[model samples]
Target: MTRIFSALVIGLIFGAGIALSGMANPAKVLNFFDVAGSWDPSLAFVMGGALVVTAIGYTFVLKRKAPVFDRLFHLPTRRDIDRPLLAGSAVFGIGWGITGFCPGGAIPALGLGYSDAWVFVGSMVAGIALARLARHTMAARAAGKAV
Candidate 1:
């Protein structure tokens, strides 16, 4: 229950921050990407601040033996980038550049009644489903089974 409550509070704060910072605005994000054109460096500062805070928070949290709500830290063990990672990252970057709405930004934008956000979020969900299906198919083929 404590974990759940903490998560709720954290999520609310994050969403509010995203909204307030104009990160939920697709045009702002697109402008940030337009480096050779009328580039907006403001989002870079926001990202840098987030990075600093996250680095400090991680340093403290990781020094502990376990998480506050769990017995052990749930961390990703993979260190090597593979084909799937590269492919997925490229796809994500392309989508983000075109739509100016990554998953994190788009969700909050949805709450603010943006139609583009709705479309982006819906497409993101469909992409996730398609990726999962592809993974299952690949796994089945690797095991010499029909998917």
Candidate 2:
């Protein structure tokens, strides 16, 4: 229950940050990709600032044995570049390029009363469901083969 509340509070802070940053505007994000026409470098600055802050946070957080809310520090174990990773990255890049609404930004953009965010979020949810189903089917096949 505490963990859930902490997550909710953190998520709200993240959403508020996104909203305040003007990143909730798809046009602002899309313009960052348009190097030939009306390119905006503000996104790059924002990314750099985030990177700096994250680096500082990581420096402090990693020094701790465990997280404040959790007993263990949850981190990615996989380091190797695999087919699934590459495919997922490509898909993510394509989606971002086309829609300019990332999962993080899209959630906050919902508060702006834009139908575009709704469509993107709905599609994202469908994609996530399909991915989970496919992964489950693949795992079942692998297990059956092993038997």
Candidate 3:
């Protein structure tokens, strides 16, 4: 119950930050992407602010032996830059360029009840499902060959 409450509070704070920073506005994001048109560079400052805060938070977290809630930090052990990572990143970039809505911004934009936001969210979900299915099929094929 405490963990759930903490998570809810964190999510609310994050959403409020996104909203207050104007990141929830699709037009702002689209304008940022439109370097050839009336481009807006405000998002760059928002991203930089986020990066600085994240860096400070991570620095403090790493200094602790254990997290306040979790038993361990459970950080990713894999550091290799492989094919799947590259392919996925490329696909994500293409989608972002076409839609101007990354998953985080998409959800908030959808909350504003825009038809385009709904369409983007639907396509984003479909892409995620397709990626998961492809990964599952590849794993199954690998297992079958090993048997």
Leading candidate by lDDT: 1
- lDDT against the true structure, each candidate: 0.93, 0.91, 0.84
RMSD to native for every prediction? 0.9, 2.1, 2.1
Better of 2 and 3 by TM-score: 2
Evaluate model 3: give its lDDT.
Answer: 0.84
Q: How many residue pairs clash in each candidate?
A: 0, 0, 0
Weakest 10 consecutive residues, lDDT, candidate 3? 106-115
Please give the lDDT score at residue 80 for candidate 2: 100
The sequence of per-residue lDDT tens digits that candidate 1 reaches over residues 74-116 is 9999999999999999999999999999888998999999899
- Candidate 2 error regions (>4 Å): 145-147
lDDT of 2 by residue, 20-97 (tens): 888889999999999999999988988898899999999999999999987999999989999999999999889988
- Pairs clashing within candidate 2: none
- List of clashing residue pairs for candidate 1: none
Q: Is candidate 1 or candidate 3 better by lDDT?
A: 1
Q: Give me the runs in candidate 3 sitting further than 4 Å from their true place.
A: 145-147
- The candidate, 1 or 2, that scores higher on lDDT is 1
lDDT of 3 at 13: 79
Q: Compute each candidate's TM-score over C-alphas.
A: 0.96, 0.92, 0.90
Count of backbone collisions within predicted model 1? 0
Ranking by lDDT: 1, 2, 3
